[model samples]
Target: MDKIHLKGCRFYGYHGAFVEEQTLGQIFVIDCTLLVDLEKAAQSDDLVDTVHYGLVFETIKKQVEQHKYKLIERLAGAICQDIFQEFPAVQAITIKISKQNPPINGHYDAVGIELERQRP
Candidate 1:
């Protein structure tokens, strides 16, 4: 199947176990790959025929910003579920949510969670 990819979307969210983390918030990067049939959209050249990526991005961004979750895995799962619920055209989705420059003692750039889901 064909796919539409949204890569490296950055957002600030309150999602961590630490007290300072929840109050201060941190930067999170999200990457999504949506699997769908693009032949119709390609042939017709119609925006309606394909998923509106901007809308999807906005939805994800809004949710991430508004909701406070302790784990990236939960956030990613919720996002995947929302996509499948909101858009029937999406056959499958893989999402990666990363926390950039987490507050850790050791040297590490980021930590993240990745999940893949399919519409039933």
Candidate 2:
């Protein structure tokens, strides 16, 4: 299938296992790979033939900024579910969520999780 890559989506959210994290919040970077068929869009050359990436970004932004969860996993799941519901042409999605500064005692880059899901 074809792909639509939405990368480097950053948002400020209160999602973490620690109370301070939920209180102070932090930055979360998300990348999404949407598996879709581009044949219709290629032929029609119309916005309606494909998913509106702007709207999709807004959907993701809403999920990230408006809600609070204890885990990024749950946030990822919510994003996938909303995307699937909002965009019928999307067949599958691969999402990566990274926390900029996690409450860990070590020197390293961002840490997070990636999840891939298909329409149910």
Candidate 3:
């Protein structure tokens, strides 16, 4: 299996269990890694045979920015599902979502959740 990774995508979103968090919003960072078979694309050097990374980035951005969720778990799951649907070549996906300066009364650069899914 071959891999494609996208890291350090930052966006501001109002997602949290707390009202203050929802109203104020915070910076969220997203990372995605996907498993794919690169042999065909590598041989043909055709965009059609391979996944369009721009579209993947846009999908991740849209999923993160356009919707509200109380848990990163759900957000991550939704992203994986969307990617699987959008890119049939994606055999598996791993996504991580992080919020910097979480309201948990601790000094941390970011708090995050990571999950992986394989196509069924």
Candidate 4:
């Protein structure tokens, strides 16, 4: 499958289990892989034939900024669902989200979750 890959898409969101993490907010980096068949777009070179990545980016941004979740897992799921709903051409999607400088014990740069889903 052909896909549009977006990496290091960052957003500040108040999403976490802890009070400090939610109230203070933090940077979240997201990597999205949107799967689709791009043959028509590749051949026709028409914007209508393919999904606009700008729209996708905006969609993600809206979701991340507007909603609060206790877990990145839930956030990932919500993102996946939104993408699939808005872009039916997508056959599958992978969403990876990370919190920078998490509050876990010891020294850790970040903590994250990667989830993939496919249309039935």
Candidate 5:
């Protein structure tokens, strides 16, 4: 299957387990890989033949910025669900969400989780 890679999508959201995190909010970085067949799109050379990444970005933005979740796992799930629902051309998705400064007492670049989901 062909792939569409949308990486380094950053958003400010209030999603965390801690009170300070939900109150102050933080930056969340997302990387998404959309699995789809691009043969028709390649032949047609038309935007309609493939998924509109700009709209996909908007969908992700709404989920990240407008809603609050206690866990990044749930957030990841929501994103996958929305993407699959909004785009029928997408067969599967792999999403990674990173929290830059998680409320943890440790020295790390970032803490994150990755999820892969397929259409049923």
Candidate 6:
């Protein structure tokens, strides 16, 4: 299947189990791959036949900003659901949510979760 990929989309938000982490916030990077048919868009050369990347980006951003989750896993799942519901043409999606410089024991730049989902 063909997909439109949005890689390394970054945002600063409050999300964590720790109080400092939530209050201070941190950088989050999201990467998404959306699977959909492109035949109609390709053949007709019409924007409507294809996914609107801007709209998708905004939707993701809006959700991320509105809600805070302790787990990146949950965030990614929510995003997947939002995308699937908002855009029925999408047959599948892969989402990765990352937190930079998390307060871990060792030196680690980031931690993340990746999830893949398909239309039912």
The alpha-carbon deviation from the true structure for residue 27 of candidate 5, after best TM-score superposition, in angstroms, is 0.3
lDDT of 1 by residue, 19-83 (tens): 88889998999999999999999999999999999988987997799998877888888888889
Tens-place lDDT digits, model 5, residues 1-120: 999999999999999999999999999999999999999999999999999999999999999999999999999999999999999999999999999999999899999999999987
Q: Name the regions of candidate 2 deviating beyond 4 angstroms.
A: none
Candidate 3: tens digits of C-alpha lDDT, residues 2-48: 99899898888878888887788888899999999999999999999
Clashes of each: 0, 0, 0, 0, 0, 0
Off by over 4 Å in 4: none
**Candidates' TM-scores?**
0.96, 0.98, 0.95, 0.96, 0.98, 0.94
Task: Give the lowest summed-lDDT range of ten residues in model 5.
Answer: 111-120
Which pairs in model 5 have colliding backbones?
none
The lDDT values for all models are 0.90, 0.97, 0.88, 0.91, 0.96, 0.87
Q: Compared with the true structure, what per-residue lDDT tens digits does model 6 show for residues 1-120?
A: 779999999887778888887788888899999999989998999989988888889878877887888877877888888998998889999998888788888877688888999987
Which candidate, 4 or 5, has the higher TM-score? 5
Residue 44, model 3: lDDT of 100
Candidate 2 lDDT by residue in tens digits, 51-88: 88999999999999999999999999999999999999
lDDT of 6 at 28: 89
